[model samples]
Target chain A: MTVQDVYLLSPEISLVGLALLVMAMDLFVKRKAVLFLMAVVGLALPVALSVMLWMDVQAEPGGRLVGVYGALTVDKFALFFKFLVLGSAALLLAASLDYAKRLTRLQGEFVGLILLSATGMTLLAAATELISIYVSLELTALPLIAMCAFLGSSRSGEAGLKFLILSGLSSALLLYGMTLVYGFTGSTYLTEIGEAMKNPLDPSVPFGGLVILVGVVLMVAGFGFKISSVPFQMWVPDVYQGAPTPVVAFLSVASKAAGFAVLLRVFYVAFPSLEMDWALLFAVLAAISMTFGNLVAMVQTNVKRLLGYSSIAHAGYLMVGLAAVASRIPNGGETSALGSLLFYLGAYTVTNLAAFFAIIGIANKIGGHKIDDFAGMAKRSPLLAAGLTVALVSLIGIPPTGLFIGKIFLFSAAVESDLAWLAVVGVVNSVVSAYYYLKVARLMYMAEPASDEETPASSISLRLALIVSALAVVAVGVAPRILTWATDAAASPLLP
Target chain B: MDLEKFLILSAVLFCIGIYGVLARRNAITVFMSLELMFTAVTLAAVAMSRYVASRQVLANPGDASEAVLQTLLTGQVFALFIIVVAAAEIALGLGIVIAFYRSRETVDISQANLMSR
Candidate 1:
């Protein structure tokens, strides 16, 4: 609204500008590749702006900058996600270049939509007000629903329809919850809600405790769909299987990360007074999600659907960290639990991106997403096969992989918070997940090729994306100090 | 007349909407159901705002009335946002339904199960 507010929102503004520029350039540019390249290069502006904001936060005494009348905050936490979302956008654009050729007409719109969604995601991370958070969430999801339908194929249309209906349903539930919270607190500001919730009982409202509890439960259900956790995870496999591979990759990583971002902010900032109640809720959800996702994933034949289930399982793992943070709040252990969650999100981003990039490369050549299609991939394209293998290993929590360190931190946090039973369930689920993840690896390495034709080589951009993400997985796995330190810094914003 | 009566009406509409969403086969019908849910939410928000405003006016008559009115507007503002967002959601939903019908020749969600195992 003011000059200073605009200054604080430079990164989001630049991202929107970049999205529009990509759309406009599509009209004049002869080659669609140029538009793709323009979008990719323009992502640097937001990344640079985020870095500047990061430095600004570091220099500030409290390491937080509230702007737009407390609707948005620029801190290490939001900056971390800005970098992650921007990085993922750049990588996805690079990986989608060859795939965009298949779309023929909507290549420019595809890139434009991705950037627009990234803009929503960055804003979602920074939004501190309830209304701002809800708007940013819709902004993030609407483009994605459109993109899911961009393929115009029957399956794509189905994916799009399902995504729209389910997303709308969740939004309605979320809005009802927000309205109830506002009714109870008489304010829409998260800080004010927190203040009001300290002693939620009031003589004016009968059954005040039960009303707030219902509101909180409904809100969690809405977020549960976003993160693709159990009971609300029915759409994940269907959407992932039917949507374009690149969109699935982006959705699996960036969408889930943004979901968690807002989840952390809303729960920690607005409803900490109800920590014990929600902690038990998340613990139960986490146990169910991990068990259900891993068990069902073992039966999936399609690689994308399998990964979809695996993502649900991963969401459950992250919820373990959430439960830990809640239970440990009184002991001042929330910081470590939250830091572990952030670190896990970062590690999962790179690892999952690596896996999807490998899938994109192979599916581009073979034109199938079946596990049978991946047979003998190791012989055809050693680099892609190895990249996927490493990623799957990381997903299984094997040593020298990023997710291994992530799981360690998360489980330790759970145990430290006296949720060792949840930690045990998480460990058992990891073991169960390895059955399917390793099955894919075995298919790639051990099985004979279904045909004698040599698979075509992957495009250069995809190759670069795979190598970068794969190397990042290993680098972060071996040297987790840098990421942990950054996550620790990001987690500080949540501390009172 | 009373806040509880309005809230009960809103809750009934919301339950009916949920039933329609879960049981309807047609995508368009399901979308209508979603809109019904949003409308219910909007009703609840407005009723709550009015209820809070009446309480404020009774508790403090004159000097604090302006501040109470401003606070009451929060719920109304939230309802406005829900309306706008619901409009956008329905527009997008209809578009996706049309697109689905074009390819599948059906708006029945059960028939759209092409990706299920």
Candidate 2:
């Protein structure tokens, strides 16, 4: 309501307005260039503004400005994720250009939804109260469902429907949990709930504390569905394979990253007192997700489905960091574990983007995404193959790759938290995951050129995307200290 | 009913909603199940607000006049948000279902499998 609050939330406000503006402009403009330009500008402006705010914040920390009854809080944590979300939108928009022209209809609306969803993600991260988080979460989810069917094709339509129904179910489950928490605590504000739970009403009858614990589990299950955690991850492969490549890329990175941002805030900020109750459940979920995803991925022939399972496995690895940080048998605190989660998310984002960039380039060229179809990828285009090599190596957590560094930090955190069993499970899963990721690499490198006619060459934009993402992966892998420091700084005072 | 009983009833309603959602194949039935879940949440919120009001009344015996206002406002707010979310969900959900029906001539979820590789 105040000027300070307006300043704090201007990035999100502008993003929403820009989304509407882009949608309106679509009605007037016929040129694809215009739509792309508008989207780029929309995403770029917010990212730049947020980055400037981040820098200014580092120079002189800003006061936490609450908007509308402590519903949303704009602080360092919010700004960090706002930058990341908007930056992701920019990258996704840039990556969408050629693919959108070829595959999808309603190009303008697709771009608009990207911006809108990023805005929603920003708010979801900033939200301090339960209702605001729920609203923002829906805002993020709605557009994502729409985007999955941007092609307006039957297959895409089915994917969209699947995502819509599954997402709605998850939202309802999460809301029910939130309602239970609110009922027990007499307030929807996380701070209030924490204060209320500082002294639990009763240890018996599954009273206030137990009800809240069940609520938290439901919330995790809901988010687990979004992040494609095992048992709740049935929709991922079908949706990813059915959707267009660019949309799949966007969903894999942006949606997953946003999910983590919210998860970190909820577990670290809102539910720190209840860490013990959630840790064991997450550890089990993590183990299942890693093992299940890797095993499923090994059998997948479709590139998108392979990546889908790989993403689920990646979620499991991230959950290892979550469980470690939230572990109750903690000797000291698990700030290092919290830092590892951030580090892994960053590494995963870059490596996954690189992999997708390569896949998109290949898909764009050959008009197919099956593993066997990539038999002569190295002979056809050495550059694209090289990019895939980097991405695949990183994905398999090979030495001198971003994922390798990420796994090291995560495992170290687990060791520090006395989660030796969980760490061992993660390592075993990582080793099993290598086989599937290597299969793609082997097909590209060792398989003979197919007898069929040559596929088309990679597009210039896609090639550029491949190069950019590959370099980023390698750069992060080589000089991980910069990312390490940032993650550590971001994760200060672990239990928010 | 007492606060505990009302809360238990809301929880039962929630479980019924879950069962319906899982067991039903019709899109409309699934939609109704979702609505049932929302209704359960509303009931829980209202009951909790009422309980808080009663506690406030007991704490400040002379200030029972504002208790009704507090409970009603909180419960109504919770209901209002839930309604908004439900409205948004229905708009999108039905849009997809109707669009699919136009193409496929069916509303059964089991028949909605066009995304297989």
Candidate 3:
């Protein structure tokens, strides 16, 4: 590979270097806090590298840099996700520092695993080849599996084992589908695959068009597990109930972001011509994920498990955007659909982090993660309770929150795409979701305080992480122009 | 040596692997089934590389650019990658299973149902 190709991968490489450095420092440092501070500060390297790369790509003629034998594409879209993953990573580390102390003996491995997974996610955003995508996906998952089970409890071990087996199965299925696609199209490059699929093939031939169809469906099924959509979402609740809160936050946000990034890239780049077909498929899945997620989430007692199901509902909403984007295939509606998807991703990322950050602090103090355990939370810890209230309201897509505006944009896009029925389903599901989301908030505010003892002061870093993320959630909702502008620009390449 | 036959065999193996993963109670057996699925994928890729891709290259010999030929043979490279990744996954899976066994003293996944509620 040329120097420029390596340049394209500089952000991921630097991040991996930081992870290694953090892990190495774990061996030498007397104060474990140094590793945390160093890991947080070391992120500056990757951040700078990505911003520089973004500028270089912007200055290029096409505003894109295809490098490393066309396996990676550096552009606004990839840069957008890179920023999302990296920024959330910094916040995740900051927010979870005290919580990570639980893994006292393995603190180094803990932070190192997070950074390593973040590297995979950043790489995922830029991957444009089938092989690169698969490699990056595994790289993202492997660390997470270790982190999931790193707690060494029976529940933690179960989470790790389930995650490992299910994730491996999904990857193998993905590989098998990739083989089928490769066999059908005779290429591994997204652009080339798209070019090959431009023409409708004869269904009469032996493997014919059916091969590509099967390949696409199987690939979607594999990724469905990553995104935690229906039929593939069985593992989420169980895993979330058992895994550490910080890892769950990272998994629910950055990992899902990367999954959607690749899904969008692959579908938009390779299967644009078949949008109507895949779009209908996504629309159906969106409906199922939203409905089932909300309905089942209503029954969950564990806060993490409830959030798990809620995240599934959110996946459905985002897919509504993806499916609606397909409806624009004929008219090529500007960036309304994909733009909403991107904006909602940014919104969901910040808001979920805020909620989970607060949970990490409060749950650490509460000694349990049950919904009932949150009773009198507001009386005990006003700051954390306030943060949770704002986050839960935002999750329900309430007014003056990022998700409210995001839902508006998404529904309008669905309407624009002539998928008004999907929009209707989305609106109905939002109302249904509000019932459960508010249940948690109401419990915190109204339920009797469980013996109002002196409230323990949470670490400053956790509060900062929670406050910043919560404020960003409200800030974006109140004045969404910046996020909208950023997301619109980020979504531009796919629309064009 | 027909590509179709190879594809059918891989597909059958993949189905069997999925079934085993779903039906097996032992985590190790489930993991082995997952490995079988990866093996099926490997076979599919190699067979595709041999029967589909090489045939395409040979059918249009003079027009093939070196870069283009490499892309055509990407299936083989993909197979190589799958093997390596699958191995890494197996190592990690076994480690996770060992962790699971240590906690509950059994590899039975059904017994690892602490959060099944």
Scored by Cα lDDT, where does model 1 land?
A: 0.90
Which residue pairs in candidate 2 collide?
A: none
Give the TM-score comparing model 1 with the true structure, all chains together: 0.97
- Deviation in angstroms for A113 in model 2? 0.5
Candidate scoring better on lDDT of 2 and 3: 3
C-alpha lDDT (0 to 100) for residue A257 of candidate 2: 76
- lDDT accuracy of residue A26 in candidate 2: 87
Rank ordering of all candidates by TM-score, starting from the highest = 3, 1, 2
- Among these predictions, the greatest DockQ belongs to 3
Cα lDDT, model 3, residue A103: 87
TM-score of chain B of each: 0.93, 0.82, 0.91
> Model 1's DockQ?
0.79
Off by over 4 Å in 1: B55-69
Candidate order by lDDT, decreasing, is 1, 3, 2
Writing each residue's lDDT as its tens digit, candidate 3 over A256-350 gives 99999999899888888764476788899999999999999998889999999999999999999989877776567646688889999999999
Q: Backbone collision count in every prediction?
A: 0, 0, 0
